[model samples]
Target: MGEKFPEIQGGGSLILAWQVRNKKVLVIGGGEVAAGRILNLLNADAKVVLISPRDGLNSEVAHRIERKQVEYYDRKFEPSDLDDPAITMVLTAIDEPDASTQIWKLCKEKRIAANIADVPPECDFYFGSVHRDGPLQIMVSTNGNGPKMANIVRRRIAANLPPNIGDAIAKVGALRRKLRVVAPGTEEGPKRMQWMSKVCLKWSLEDLCEMEEQDMDELLQSYAPDQIPSLSQVRLGEEPGTWQFDGSFGWACVV
Candidate 1:
């Protein structure tokens, strides 16, 4: 008998954050799809150029055009638009299939990444569900297969996260900055990072959010005395064997 192998699933796309701030982005439609893409680009601080026939624009898109938030070209897309050296990416949501195909081909020839709405095979990327909390942003994708499912998953994950998670992250960042100054050495970065990871693992999100600088300094003294000069001889008044760490059972302390 011949050997058999398990079937593999569809190829997954790599998720990344594109640095598009202040870069030129081209959108080739002015309907709801184009409006949504424009808003997302604007949120990222990208300079957008929207091109579509004047009669084809939706009311919302027209309103933005009237306000001059975006550079609106009241005409159909032309190949010359792709020739702009400043254009970093292109997005097409035109109803005409031929126009969409032409835009995709032109983008490929120009080595510019592009997304064609409702056409996964023609797109270089897919629009995914995004959830943002301060500096923390989460993106969920279904490989251009199921957008509704991706949105549902994104909402569920967002709902389960603690409201103070962003605050906790900010506190940790401040602690890291302080540690860098107080503990200047070659291995300071990795050592402090490891200590911080351990602290995060052991402490609840609420505790992290509420912890003060003095409390963090004490924690550094207890867990990483060698890293900081001021914490070398500082002790938490606990015996050597009072606290124990078990690989399988986690951390425990004697009462």
Candidate 2:
């Protein structure tokens, strides 16, 4: 029998966490697709502007419009809508293919990314199913191929994560800040990163959550007493000052 090779899939996209806060997002049409995207933008604190006939809006979206939570323009979309400099991204969910295509073309000319519902070719980006735990967020995507599968994976991953994972991360972040202040030297960057990696490998989630500041200080003294300055040596009232990255992959502290 001949050996068989598994088939490889293509068209994967680079996913990123966009800082859409205070940015203007435009949506065309008033159906379920538009409603979902609008809600997501609102959650991110993005200023959303919806242009539609206002007759066929989803019930929840209509309720939001009634409450004036979203800026709604009850009219067909016009090319002039893209002229607004505040508009960063556009989403089109109109039933008419011609209208969606026109909006997408205009967005291209305006250098704005656009997403057209049920039309992958017309989209500059695709929405992913996201799971969030405080500052921790996980996004799963199938390159606009299988959204339901992405949602399933996201739910599974969210369920598997420790409930106190966010707290653990926060504790580690605090420890890192203290390390930077007490151990500001050329070699401190790599040493700190290596120490953090060891900490993650050695400590459990519960251990991290229960770690106190005093314990962290004690641990630092025990681990690298020679590298870190004594607590009494650090000026209590003075700021730690800014850290600048040297071209040689080291950090220089500028007071």
Q: Top model by lDDT, which number?
A: 1
C-alpha RMSD of each candidate structure in angstroms: 6.4, 9.0
- Measured against the true structure, the TM-scores of the candidates, in listed sequence, are 0.74, 0.72
Model 1, range 143-202, lDDT digits (tens) per residue? 889999999999999999778777777777777677777777876777766666665655
Q: Pick the candidate with the highest TM-score.
A: 1
What's the CA error at residue 33 for candidate 1, in Å? 1.3
Q: What is candidate 2's lDDT per residue for 201-230, written digit by digit as tens?
A: 555567667777876776565346333322
Residue 13 lDDT in candidate 2: 88
List ranges where model 2 is wrong by over 4 Å: 1-9, 66-69, 174-188, 211-255
Q: Count the backbone clashes (under 3 Å) in each candidate.
A: 0, 0
Candidate 1 matches the true fold with a TM-score of 0.74
Model 1 alpha-carbon drift over 4 Å, by segment? 1-10, 66-68, 177-187, 211-255
lDDT of all predictions: 0.78, 0.76
